[model samples]
Target chain A: MGLNLEFMLSIIPELLSAMVITLQISILAVLLGIMGGLVVGSFRVIGPKWLKMLIQLLVDYIRGTPQIVHILIIYFALPRIGIILNAYWTGVVALTIIATGYEVEIVRTAIESIDKGQIEAGLAIGLLKRQILIFVLLPQAIRRIIPPLTNELTNIVKASAFLSVIAVNELTKISNKIIYETFYFFEVLILTALIYTVIITLLGMLSNFIEKRMFSTNSEANS
Target chain B: MDISFMIEIVPRLLRATWVTLQVSAISLMIGLVFGIVLGVLRVYGNRFIVWCTKGFVIVARGTPAAIQIYAAFFLLPRLGIRLPLFAVGVVALTFNTSGYQVEIVRAALESIDKGQIEAGLAIGLTRWKTMLYITLPQAVKRMMGPMTNEFANLIKASSALMLISLYELTKSGHAIIAATFKYAEVLVLVALFYFVLVQSLCKLSAYLENNVFNFGKTADPRNEFLN
Candidate 1:
C-alpha cells in the first residue's frame, strides 16, 4: 500500500511536541559542554606542561570513541559502580562528554588563532596575563568560536536522538512509538527526517546571520 | 572488574572490531565513489542534478545517523525489500558518509583555479581530458588529508550500527556485558579496543599525509596532529 499520509498528518503534532524534549536535551548539553569545555580547554592552553599532557590524553580518549558507547557505558555500566542514572541524565552526560571534547578542540584552536604579538603587546604595555587574556585574547576567540560552537549545537541536537535507545522519550523515540502503532513506517520516518532537516537548516541559517552581522567588515571572520 | 573477564572478552571484541572495520571499509570505498560523482554533479551537472545531489547531502547530514539506521532497518522491510543486517549497516553508513565526503570533494574541486581548466582546454584538451589530466589530479592531492580524516570518522561513526542490533564492535561489547555482568570493566575494554583501532588508523593516515603529500607545506591547522 502507498504511504498513509493521513496517519502521517495525524502524528505530526505529537512529533513536533516531542521535539521540545529533544531541544531541551540539546540546550542542556550545549550549555554544560561550553562550560566544561572552557574549563578543560583553557587549562590545556594555560596550565602547566604536565597538566597539558594529562588533559590532552583525556580529550583524545573521549574524542576518539563514539557517543553511543559513552551512552551505553554511562547508563548501563555506571550502575555497576552504584551510580544509577535514569534515562535523561545518561544522554546528557554522554553528549556533554562528547561535545566537551569537540569544544576543547574548538577553544584550543580559537585561542591559538589569536596573534602572539597581540598578547606580547599587552604584556609590553604592562598588563597582567589575566588582563591580557580577558582584554585581548578572549574577544578574538569568542567571535571565532561562534561558527564552530553553533555547529556543535546542531551536533548536540542531532546526537540527542540517540537517547531514544535508553527510553528518553525525545523526538526520535516518540516517533518510533507512533511508527510501532501505525506501521506508517516510511511516512513517519520521512516526517521525522524532515523535522530534523528543518531544525538543522534553521541552525545553519542562524549561523549565517550571525556571521554576516558580526563579520560584515572583517574579512578574516568570513570563515 | 575481574582480570579474567577482561582477558576472555578481548578476543571476541577483536573479532567484532573486524566486523566494524569491514563495514567501515566497504562503506568508505562506496562513499568515496558516490561522493566523487555527487561532488562532480554539484560542479558540472545540470540544474536538476545539482538540486537532487544537494538535497541528498542536506537530508543525509541533517539527521542523526542512529535515526537513519533505524529507519532503514525497520522501514525498508515493509516495502518487500529485506536486506541482510550487514547490508543494512553498510547501506546506512555508506549513505551517511557519502554526504560528508561529497562536501569535502566538492570544496576541493571548487577551489581549483578557473584558469587551470581553461588553460587545459586552450592547449587542445577535451573537457573530460581536462578533468582527468588537470582538475582531478590537483583536487585529489588536496583532498588526501581530509579524506583520511573522514575515513577515521567512518570507523567511529560505524559504532552507531549497534542501534539496529548489528553485531559490530559496540554491540559486541553489549553482549559481553550482558553475558558476564561486568558492565564497567567490559565496556572499558570495549572503549580501549575502539581507541586503539581509531588511533592506529589516524596514525597511518598521518604517516602517509606527512611523508608523501608534503608539497613543501608547513602544518595546516587540521594537519597539526599529523606531524
Candidate 2:
C-alpha cells in the first residue's frame, strides 16, 4: 500500500508488451494519416471549389470533436451500416481520422507558407502543376512542416490510450487491468505515465534536433 | 436512427452540456492563472524553477489526458483523500490545460522584444514594473489567440471526464444509447453538441486574431498544436 516498487517493476514487462501495441497503432496511424493528409490536403488546395468545401467541413468535424467520441462512434455506429471493425482497427480508424484532420492543415499551411514566387518560378521552368507540387513545393513544405507533423505524431501516440476505453489491450487498458486486480492504482498509473512521458520527451528532443538541422542547412543554402 | 429519440434527448443532453461547460470554464480559469505564473517562471524564474516548469509541461502534455483524469478519480481515493466527482474532473482538466497554457505563455512572453525590457530598465523602471507595463500588455494580445484555442481544446478534452463517470454530455449520450440502443443517432447528436461548442470558440479565436489583435498585419497561422 505504501509503494510497491517491486510490483511496479514486475508489471513493466506486461506493460511493455502493451506498449508495442501502442507503437504499432501509432506508427500505422501516422503512415495512413500522412498519406491521407497529403491527398486530402492537396485536393483542398488545388481541387475544385465544391470539393474544397466538402473537405473543409470534414476537417472541422474531426477537429472539433474529441477523440474519445470518435472512437465510440466508430465502435458503435459502424456496425449499423454493416462496417464492423474490432477495437484495434476502430482505434486505427479514429486516430487516423484525427491525425489526418490536423495534418491536412499542417500540409496546407506548410504548402502555403512557401512563397507564391516559388510556384511561378516552377511554371517558368516548364514544370507541370503536378510536377511542381512534387519536385518543388512538397520538398520545401516537408522541411517547414516537420515540427507540426512531429507534434501531431506525438499526439497520435498519446491519443492511442483512448482506445483503452473500448477494451483494446494497449498500455492504459493493461494498466487498468492491473489496477483492478491488485488495486495498485498509484504505482501502476505512475509507471504508465512515465512510459508515455519518456517516449514523448524523446520525441520532442528529436523534433527539436531535426528542426535545428533542417533550418541551419536551409540558411546555409540561402547564404 | 430514430429522429424522434434524438430530438427527445436534446433537453437531457443540454442539461449535461451545462455540466461540461461548468467543468471546462472552471478549469480554464484556474489553468489560465497557473499557466501565467508558470509561464513567467519558465521565462524569468531561477534555474530550479525553470527546470521544474519544463518537467511539468512535458509530463502533462506527454501523457494521455484520460490517464490524468483517471489518476485524479482513482488514485486519490486510494490515498485516503475524498472529493466530489465534479472537483476531480476540474482538477484533472486544469492540470492538463495548464500544461499547454504554460507553453503558450512562455512563447508569447519570449516573443516580447528584449530591447524594450532593457529600455524600460534604462528609464529607471524596476524589473517587475517593466514586465507589468511593457511586456505583459504586448504578450496579452498575443496570448489571446492561443489561449482561445486552448479553451476549445479544454472543452473538447473535458469529455474525457465521462471516463471517470462524471455525468457530462458524453455520459448523457451513453445513458440514452443504453436505453434506446440508438448508437448512431445519439452519438452523432453528442458529437454535434461538442462541435457547436468548440466551433464557436474557434470562431471567436479567428475574430480576435484577425479583427481585435490584427493591427493591420496579416495573422500568423502558426499555432496548430492545440487544434
Candidate 3:
C-alpha cells in the first residue's frame, strides 16, 4: 500500500499529545527509580547483613526478570490483590522498579570506584561514617554516576513503549490506535519511530555535553 | 497464600521453562552468528554498510522489544508475510540481540592491540588469515564476559514473547495465577525462578572470567566479591 501523508498529518496532533504522556511517565519513573536506587545502593554498601542480602536479592530478581513480565504481573496481578492501579501508574511503578535495579548497580559501582584513600582520610579527620558518606564520598560518586544514570534514563524512556501493551495511551499506543483507525501502518509507525529517535538522540547529546562539562571541571580541580 | 496450589503448578511451570529455554537458546545462537557478521561489517565495511549497521543497532536498542515483536507478529502478516508466534519471537529476538552483540563484538575486535595484527602480517599471513588466527582468538577471549551477560539479558528479554502468546515461563505463570487467583504468590515464585537462573548464569560468567578469560590479570578484588 502506498503511504498516505494526509492521514499521517491528521494524527500528528493526537500523537504529540500522547507523546506528552510518554514523557511524563518516563521522567517520573526515572526520578522515582533514582531515589529508590540511592536507598538500595546505600543499603548494599552499609546496611546490616540481613538487610544487605535482602536488598541484593531484590535487585537480582528485578534484574533477572524482564520489565515486560514485571509490567504484566503488576498490571494484571495487583488488581486482584485490592491494590488497583491504573495502567499508567502500573507502567510507571514497574519501570521504576526495574530501573532501580540497574541504577543501584550503576550507583554502587560509581561509589566503589572512588579511591579508598579519600574515605580513609575523611574518617581520620574526625568525620563519622555517615558524615563521610554524605559529605565527601557521595559528592564525588554522584559526579561519576551522572553519565550512566543519563543512559539509564534514556533506556527507561524507550522502555515506556512496553506500557502500550497494558493500554497506556503513550506514543506507541497512540500510533497503534492510529494504525488501527486508518490502516496506514507503515507511515504512522515510521513517524512514531522518527519522533522517538529525535527525543532519544537529543537526550544522548545532552548527557554527553554534561559529561564533558563535569570532566573539565574535575580535571581543573585536580590540576 | 495457598502453598498447595503453587506446588501443583510446579510441573506446568517446569514444562514452560523448557519452552523459554528453547526460545532463548535458539535466538542466542542465531543472533551470535548474525552479530559476528554485522560486527565485521561494522568494523571493516564501507560507509554505507556502517550506516546501515548503526541504524539497525539504534532502532533495535532504542525501542522496546515488545514493539518489535508486535511489528513482527501483527504488521508482518498484513504485508502478506505470516509466521507462527514462535518463529516471530525467535526472529524478532535475533534481530534485537544482534544489534547489541554487534557493538560488543566490534569493541572486542578493536580491543586487540594493533601491533598483534602487524606481527601477523610480518609473518606473511594474509589479511583474512591474520583476522582468523590472531585477531579473532583474542577478541573471543575478551568477549566472553560481555557475551555471557548478553546471553543472560536475552533470557530475560524472552519474557516479552508472552505478548504474542508464546506460553513461555511468564505466560505460564499468568495462566496459573488466572486460575488460582494467587497473584502475589505465583508472581513471586516466577520471579524466584528467574532469579535463580540468571544468578547462576552470572556466577558462571564470573567463573569463566576468572578461569579462562583472565588475560587481564589485574582483576579488581571487589568484582570478585560482587560475583
Candidate whose TM-score is highest: 2
Model 1 agreement with the true structure over B1-227: per-residue lDDT tens digits: 58987888788888999999999999999999998988988877889999999999999899989788988787668768889999999989998999999999899988999999999999999987898789989999878878878878888889889888899999888877778777878888888888888777777667667677775654543322100
Order the numbered candidates by lDDT, best leading. Answer: 2, 1, 3
Chain B TM-score list for all models:
0.91, 0.93, 0.92
Superior candidate under lDDT, 1 versus 2: 2
Better of 1 and 2 by DockQ: 2
Docking class of 1: medium
Prediction 3 global C-alpha lDDT: 0.82
By DockQ, rank the candidates, best first. 2, 1, 3
TM-score of 1: 0.94
Pick by lDDT: 2 or 3, better one: 2
lDDT of 1 at A47: 70
Q: Which residue pairs does candidate 1 place in steric collision?
A: none
Give the per-residue lDDT digits (tens) of candidate 2, residues B1-227.
68887888899999999999999999999999999999989998899999999999989999999889989998778768899999999989999999999999999999998999999999999988998899988998999999999989998898888788899998888877888788888898999999999989999998898898885765644322111
Q: Where is model 3 more than 4 Å wrong at Cα?
A: A76-83, A220-223, B215-227
What is the DockQ score of candidate 1, to 2 decimals? 0.57
Question: Can you tell me which runs of candidate 1 are displaced by over 4 Å?
Answer: A77-84, A217-223, B218-227
Best by DockQ: 2
Clashing pairs in 2: none
Give i-RMS (Å) per prediction. 3.5, 4.7, 3.0
Q: Which ten residues in a row have the lowest lDDT in candidate 2 chain B?
A: B218-227
Task: Encode model 3's per-residue lDDT on B32-115: one tens digit a residue.
Answer: 898888998888779999999998888877766766776777677878988888888898888789988999999999999999
